[model samples]
Target chain A: MNIHIIGGGAVGLFFAAQWCEKHAVTLWTRTEQQAEMISRGGIRVLENHMENIYPVNSKKIESLYVEGDLVVVAVKQYHMKEVLPLLQNAAAQSVLFLQNGMSHLDFLEQVPHPHLYAASVEHGLAKIDGRTIQVNGRNKTNIGSLRSGTAGIIDQLQTGSFRFDWNENSYHMLIEKMAANAIINPLTALLKVKNGEIAENARFRAIAKDLSREFASVFSYKTAEDTFQSVLSICTKTADNESSMLKDMKAGNLTEIDAIVGVLLKTAEKNHRSVPAFQLLYNMIKGKENTPEFMSK
Target chain B: MNIHIIGGGAVGLFFAAQWCEKHAVTLWTRTEQQAEMISRGGIRVLENHMENIYPVNSKKIESLYVEGDLVVVAVKQYHMKEVLPLLQNAAAQSVLFLQNGMSHLDFLEQVPHPHLYAASVEHGLAKIDGRTIQVNGRNKTNIGSLRSGTAGIIDQLQTGSFRFDWNENSYHMLIEKMAANAIINPLTALLKVKNGEIAENARFRAIAKDLSREFASVFSYKTAEDTFQSVLSICTKTADNESSMLKDMKAGNLTEIDAIVGVLLKTAEKNHRSVPAFQLLYNMIKGKENTPEFMSK
Candidate 1:
């Protein structure tokens, strides 16, 4: 099988490295430096279970053929607008998105893609010191086809990369994952605290629960309670993993708070749900994110 | 004038130091060490405008003379229940409370003694390093009798110690002070931010306004707008000051959140006004205060 990976971030590089052992894989990266590094040396995956850097082909997407059996879109949600259009030849192929949230629904609806597989991953992977990569744990990863006819795509990807599953109720799974993300991610980021801090605080829990309730209302499901419990479990599972949101905030980078929390809030507004707690949380985080140092201090 | 000051915290020591300049003053304290400090070396008040260690007699009040020219009770609200009997002597003559929030109402209802002056303070004084006191800024002090025929008391105190004013409407003044304390104190404390943070974040201002609205509804007054504006002014005046509530939270001591926020919220319930934000803030602070580090961290 021939595979083309878009966006040479952690997930993209990880998947390329994993599949290159059995299949011909080409990672489409934007930078000449990264492309040259991967073309010369496959990919370095410092996995918790195994540690090694294998060689693979990496090239600029414009110079390589996009007509592949599978194309993995691993770009940030904000970057998907530009990157999605670049995969013109792979419109008929199954595209697996290994990103965090489902903010690409508008793009998904607009584009006539043949098959789509959405995944919500709790894997602790980080590009260490900008040169190497490290996977702290073999965390749970869920993947499923959005369309009913493409169940086989989910089956084919079940080969030993990480744990992946198929669900008839894939939308519920996405919303559940989304609810958890909205609650934990922004708070961990805003507070500059670990994932465990949310569970440790009843106020934080209440705020998270309220926000989840708003999301559940929009999705027409009551999953916040279960999802909140799952969040606590994830805290214990990945206790040492600094959440992406937290890292973004610490680095003074703009967090994907809009994709994770803002989307849920907008959806709730569209659904006409009253979410005062979430509204307060949203306002607080937005203020913290936009606040100047003098005012904040 | 002969005066006796109870509770050797910032406010008590604050008024004691001021009143001792011209009058015979005694500071009653619980901690023998603090009592000894005041008795031997005198009370040191280092104000931005002035600095002095004025000598004053210090002792524990097992009992007191039933007659005095003036007395100021400045204990915390929670301690008021146990200390009311102790104030019986002072209540017979002339008594002024220089404490935060509407905590004095409980004592006023139970013991309706004549010649009572319920005062509200915005003076920014704090005990910096146990022995040393720091006055951050000058804020007006308001004093008035809860009942009639105490104009002389208000006038006498206003003429001397501090920048004082007499309000004919003392209940309204109490409510106004309650509104200010309810708004400014808890937010600065719980958010672990300075006073200016409230003005910087509009959400905190909204919460402050909501709390004030709740107070207005219960007390049948229209001080919400004025009180909120005053709070913003305070945010500027004490931009660098850590509020008493914040100080208490940092010290792991019980915050006056109850006296400031809780009392107002309870009043809101009595008047059938829903104070969602204030109730939420109160619950969070109370929960954090009661729970141990294991539960909250």
Candidate 2:
């Protein structure tokens, strides 16, 4: 099987480095410069204090061809829309979206793709530099089929370090993952604290409750307290780890604010639920994201 | 004339350095170690590409004696209560407060001192190291007499660099100054941006308006829109500078959240007014203030 990984980010690099052992992998990046670097030197994984290189064919997304490939969209939610047209322009045997947040879900439902899937990539991977990825935490790719009558892509994607799980219902899986993501991602990014801080810090926990309660109103939760408890547990479990949103903000990458907070805020407005904490943080992250680190004298 | 400056922070050092030249100035620090360091080395002023030392007597707050001295309480709002008893122990000729926020206003209302005053010190100052200070923005100390018919302390506080203004109505002056501080201080500190970013950044400005409106409810504003415009103008004027709260957070000092936001929240709660934005920032600053930067592994 041939896997075409869209995006040369930390996610795409990790997948390409892992799945290349089982199947042929081609990496697609936004720029030809990154593709050329990866094509010439290959992806480097700095793991267990050792440098290991994985060979894969890398190309620019501007020249993407997905006819005979299983295209796994690994780009951020902010950039997912830009790449969606390219997938529609070509025909892939299977298209799997590994983006965060529910922003892309609406766009996916309208598409006539017969074999469509969405995934939650639960991993701590950092792209150190050009074609170099540093793997930290263990990874599990949760796959859910978006389209009916489609055999999932779980069988095609497995490696020694990479794990895969097939969910019976994709929407619920995304919601569950999002419950944690929506709570943890923006808070860590805004506060510039580790994941555990949200649960450990009393004030953060207070605000977290506000966020969870607001989030619960938009989605279905038995109680906001139960939702908050779940979010706190996730925070405690990943206490030492800096969230992906924090990492993205630190690296000056555009965050999935629109998909995660923006979409939920839209729902909240539609429902007439007053979610001040969520709205406050959304505005904060948007400000920080839009504003440069250094300003003029 | 003798001047007693409480709290050996940037503001204290600035006043002490200026006043010591004209008056018999005694600097009071929280610890004996800092007092001893200043007593031995003198206060170093790094200015205009030259390092100059200003000599003055320094003592620990524990050994405070304000018999005939004009006492200037230049402590942060968090530590104001701790030093209040010391002031009560010794009857100073005049007691002038140089603190931020309206938190100290209530404490001053019942005090029967004939020469009680509240001040708003507008300056950008940074203490480089132990017993060393770096001045940035020009200084203006707005003095208002809290005790009715008491002569103001502005006449005794003239210096070449340091400026003072007597506010006829102290309450209104503090409120007006607070309109800017409450918005700029926490926002700049929380966002980790310079003062100007609040105005320059659209998202920050939106949240600033939210904060301004909520704050206006606690106090009285002609309109929240007017309050926000004033706050934005302050941000634009000091766009290149960092707020004292941001500097304090960076330096791991206790912030004026309690005095600024905490007191406002209390008033808001009393009036049955909803100030979620103010409450959110208060909680955030409190969390960041209480939580350690480096967590135990």
Question: What TM-score would chain A of each candidate receive against the reference chain A?
Answer: 0.87, 0.92
Cα displacement (Å) at residue A243, model 2: 2.4
Q: What lDDT score goes with residue A158 in model 1?
A: 51
- Per-candidate DockQ vs. reference: 0.21, 0.41
Per-prediction TM-score: 0.82, 0.84
lDDT of 2 by residue, A1-297 (tens): 787888998999988989888888888898889999999999999876889998888998885646655788888888877887887765666778887888888888555567888888877777888699887666588888888624446766766668898898888778777878888998888777889889988898988887777788888644788889988877776667788888878767778888888888898899888777788888988877734352110
A4-48 per-residue lDDT for model 1 (tens digits): 788887777767766777777888887878888878766777865
lDDT of 1 at B32: 76
Candidate 2, residues B16-108: lDDT per residue as tens digits? 888878899899998899899899988988766778888989999885646755788898887877887787766676788888888887687
